[model samples]
Target: MADSSPSLDPVELGAYFDLIEVTSLLRHAVEQQLREAGELSYVQFQLLARLGDAPSGSHRMTDLADGVVYSRSGLTYQAGLLEKAGLVIRTPSPDDERSTTVTITEAGRERLAAVLPGHIEVVKGLLFEPLSRDDVTALAGLLAPVREHMRATPPRSAAPRRRGKVS
Candidate 1:
């Protein structure tokens, strides 16, 4: 192995490790709860939640991909699955013929309704139980800047896709 100096200080390393472990554990539990309650994947639930929250009850496929921070191809595939299940409908966007719009159906809303209680419970039990209100406020305050900094770099989904064949 090539030798390299350790860059992170012990405090930084501990914080990073703690963040990773907590997110991993939280995601695992959330995924299980989503599957058991609504038969949805974490990504699918995110998509539905976004659609449900949209004023128009719909969003462009590209926007959804960006909003969810998912790959374009993966978002397309997940949308297809949701379409097959009759939980969402994908239509050619009225604003842009080349783009698709995904809208949650009534069934999708119902599925979310079924899942939310369990989802909230899981989040509360695993992520919030140990934290006091002040702790949570401090955590959010501490993490917001980090999240913003990471987001300063454009997400892959924000880039223009090459259409057809590249010369």
Candidate 2:
């Protein structure tokens, strides 16, 4: 029997490989810059950046885990480390009894501020340098729908955890 799986044509295959390589390169550079500038791991920086950007300066931990595409337990551990560093505060959510909220503290903002310049430089050099304004716009236009399609399903973190063996 023939294998029954969809396959990419050469153009699509090349595009997929190029996208993966570029993202990996960009992430590595960004991680290095974040570590050097603020002593933050990539996930910690993402959490702080999200909190800092929120108008209310906070979000429920579940929302954070989904937004960052990180596992819930991993997010919890990272939040705990930030709490110990006095960079963020975790509190019981006023709006949701079962949910915990995380807020970026002043120190978190300072740390984010300290890292923004280097982060921007790294991103610019690695990701945006070769792209023209039109290329950047086209890239976003192309990827936005794909991103939306992927996000149409609930994030993995939003799924209920299985407790028993499957049949």
Candidate 3:
């Protein structure tokens, strides 16, 4: 009988696992920091941060969905939560009758300000503290292609959320 199990090269598997482990740790730390700083979930923080950085203090909900790589319905839920918090406003997109735009409110900006320092410190401590400057640069270069490759396919989250579970 022929052995038919698929095998990845050990070095490739190690690299893949290392990336996953590091990002998992980083994500949990940042999520906790964001929750503590502003009572924001990670997705809410991402949405607010994106809105805060827009040149005109607003962005299309579609664009925000893409920026955060989150499902449109999920982003909508986050937006609603933020709006209820007085942290953001959602209005019809003036440029598109069918689209919505989200703008950061004063409270949103305040929340972002509250979140930034801790976010920066947490990221720096977790992601950069162990790396040399050259390692940082090299890591960015290595990840760029992988990110672009994944982005080319625009994952399912790029679309609206499914209404029901599959049978």
Candidate 4:
């Protein structure tokens, strides 16, 4: 359990709560759009979109998971789904035989192309419609460093299983 003592000042703590709420709202909205448009989950769409956008149209599985903020194990599942759909293929990594690579297929590209317009619209509506130019810039500037730092650590969902009992 967290200590009762507050680590941040009241205003800062409130801001954190606000950020969490806003993020959830935005995520829910995007999920709806994705589900309706292509029956895709956010992570699945993220994988396809990233692969589609990759210069080489492929990325190592671990790299893809990190980039998309998914756990490595979860990414494996999503990748499997994409492969089964004929949207992508998982194969031996040319750079390292021990690792796998995910490459977007024509079908994957087509799927991404199909969903992108709706995705962009949803983003603009939920995230950009109210923000002024300066608001957008300032928000990005404020968040970018924190995002970069967190990117160094894999998310809990994707972290390797820990060998320990819960308290």
List pairs with backbone clashes in candidate 2. none
Clashing pairs in 1: none
lDDT of 4: 0.89
Estimate the lDDT of model 2: 0.94
The Cα error of candidate 3 at residue 98, in Å, is 1.6
Model 1: runs farther than 4 Å from truth?
1-6, 160-167
The alpha-carbon lDDT assigned to residue 98 of candidate 2 equals 86
lDDT of 4 by residue, 1-167 (tens): 87898489899999999999999999999999988988789999999888888899999998887688777778999999989999999999998997999999998888888888999999999898999999999999999999888777755546667879888
Instruction: List the candidate 3 regions with Cα displacement exceeding 4 Å.
Output: 1-6, 155-167
Clashing pairs in 3: none
Under the 3 Å rule for N, CA and C atoms, how many clashes does model 2 have? 0
Q: What's the ranking of the predictions by TM-score, best on top?
A: 2, 1, 3, 4
Candidate 4 local Cα displacement, residue 128, angstroms: 0.8
Please list the residue runs of candidate 2 whose C-alpha ends up more than 4 Å from where it truly belongs after superposition.
1-3
Predicted candidate 1 versus true structure: per-residue lDDT over 21-117, tens digit per residue: 9999999999999999889999999999999999888999989988899999999999999999999999999989989999999999999889999
Each candidate's number of clashing pairs is 0, 0, 0, 1
Q: What TM-score goes with each of the models?
A: 0.92, 0.95, 0.89, 0.87
For model 2, residues 1-167, the per-residue Cα lDDT tens digits are 99789999999999999999999989998999999999999999999999999998899999999999999899999999999999999999998888999999999999999999999999988888999999999999999999999999988866889889988
Q: For model 3, where is the 10-residue window of minimal lDDT?
A: 154-163
Instruction: By lDDT, rank the candidates, best first.
Output: 2, 1, 3, 4
Deviation from truth (RMSD, Å), model 1 = 2.8
